[model samples]
Target: MGMHDNSRCINCEWAVAGTGQKFCPNCGQPTPVHRIDWHFLGHELEHSVLHMDRGILYSLKQLMLRPGVLLRDYIEGRRGNQVKPLLLITMMSAAVVLLNKLVSGGSLIDGGAHQAIATGQAVPEQLQQFMLASRTVGEWISGHFAAFTLMLLPFEALTFWLVFRRFSRLNYPEWLVISTLLTVQTFVIWLLLIPLHRWLPYAQSLAGLMGMVYGAASLMQFFATRPLLSTLWRTAVALGVFSVTSTVLVLVATIVVTWRA
Candidate 1:
């Protein structure tokens, strides 16, 4: 048929050049393009794993070098290269929990100690026994960890609100920076508790005081951007709120654990 003829292949709207062709060249109809046997699953897995690893490394680097920079970047829409904040916190918390369990010699709450106490037997006068009587050391630490993290969320929101009160535009970014700082602080607390406990076995009161001090100091890092008076005031309020909230949360966690047991 002529190039301009209307009788051309209707499917492709191509001029019929010959009669022997099985399919239209323009549209490739009747004989479609064959699907290639590409290893799509393998490629997807590889890409996903590579991206996850890269994100983790990027998060770790920011955490180590700049402390609160990840939250700031993430809140500013610069999240493509790093792990998500919640995921980063969870992964680090899980690792810390595992390590603490390993070092503490067993579950923070020793079932054996609990059983002995239940049976009205004389318990050994040791750290583990005290943990059993009070709560497992691991359980105590875990409860505190959970309480500490949860308590930070509101304090973080408040700190950001106060610190960037003038910069209305950067409020959320500031909050995120506070969150990241707290997450890093939690990781640090877990790391430090091991050595502190080992060195001062009979110093539970000292340990509690140190914990409060460190918690206050960690939070002060965020308020450092403000004037000295503002920093002190905000830090004091935040610390008070954090302490009260954390104490309540840990108490509830302990009650629940005891009830369940």
Candidate 2:
């Protein structure tokens, strides 16, 4: 009947807004959609359920091939095609965690060291508080494994900002985005190495080394105008500064935590 033929959306009564309006303006469902079928169900499952066609792999591939260019582009606002930095790192973090759990059945942080510090009676007098503070830090990190991993974002951003300030016109938040994608790079390296090393602790050293090398390469590309040797030394300084700063923070936090306790 004539009544069966209408320009309105089936999901919502909003009429087609324009000649080529693909989705309803009111409800946002596709206008004049296909009837349910096995093929539609399968396609929906792939697209929505698993996100089989998502930007996850594409982002990783781009990062691998051109880390500095990709990150610099992303920071400069050329980010429509790939996965966002935060999501990429978060997903990579989950992958690393899952793989660690499957292989070692152990937490990324070493709880036994903390437990030993708590239980031992002969930790010496002066070192006792220090040990306890370390234990406190370790416990928190262990308990919040995912968060602990992501916690490096800001500090890393600050570290890079300080070392590369002369070269980069980027602000603090932009550095954070750059840091996050770099973190995704690190996590991807960890994911690959952890399985071979059979656990986090064993794989961690090599993973860290590989990550630093990757960072150096990325910096070289990002600062392509600079000599490669100059970029390499700057990356080295950045890593050293990051390490020292992180150590100081942990020690200061340990003292504060123990003092308050």
Candidate 3:
């Protein structure tokens, strides 16, 4: 403990006691010199304890080992030691997309452009020219896919929140938190499976299916809190809503992009 004679709160500059005082009474900040010695690694040890729980590895481990339980705890006001949902998802999605670019050296969504050209079904000259001239746009889309996900996430969360309305009266933001974490988990799966796509051929599809199952399980476990059949039906309804909403958004975006091109 810091000495009362020389001890002070770093944050509020208030005096603190030297003996048996773990924290400052005035500012609530932990005392820095808790029986410190020149050779002892107290600062490092304190940092390790305070920061280890907030690391990406800790969040990933929780997501992988007990995603439903983690979400439940987080939603039920037990968030002291857990990662923030938005930050965790953002980091996961960024890591997934960056690693994907490193491994493939191409845009993941470029397959759609390739397929359109390959069809050769009386393609319009302007459309073909636009497509050819849109490599930069495609790269931008690839790099910003995570941003797109975040933008569309509120609508996705709405689907579940609407379908499972009876289970919880919380507003959209609460559901958005759940959706973000689930989406991040999907990105994790995508990162793991993208490299295997060449050999497995259907690896991406498998990952997508796993993501859907994981999302459904999370919803059912965290929100539904009902019988298996009832929870499954609610999950199906949410998925249906998400699918229709995504399709409409994609069509609209495609039209806008093509028009602008």
Identify the leading candidate in terms of TM-score. 3
Off by over 4 Å in 3: 1-6, 19-23, 28-30, 33-55, 115-122, 126-137, 200-205, 223-225
* Local distance difference test, candidate 3: 0.73
Candidate 1 residue pairs in clash (backbone atoms < 3 Å) = 108-136, 108-138, 109-136
Tens-digit lDDT string for candidate 3 (136-182): 45566677886877888999899888987885676788889888888
RMSD (Å) per prediction = 11.9, 4.7, 4.9
- Model 3 clashing residue pairs (backbone): 1-34, 1-35
For all candidates in order, the CA lDDT equals 0.55, 0.75, 0.73
| TM-scores of the models, in the order given | 0.51, 0.76, 0.78
Prediction 2 global C-alpha lDDT: 0.75
Compute the lDDT of residue 92 as modeled in candidate 2: 81
Candidate 1 per-residue lDDT over residues 40-96, each given as its tens digit: 566554554445445565566655555535445655577777666666676666666
Backbone clash tally for model 1? 3
lDDT of 2 by residue, 1-261 (tens): 133233887776778766588888899888666657899898776664346334677678879888877877787788876787777777788887788778877665444445556576576655777677778786676566568667767898898888778876878888888778777787888888777754345576577778888988887898888788877887899877876876787678888887887
Descending-lDDT candidate ranking: 2, 3, 1
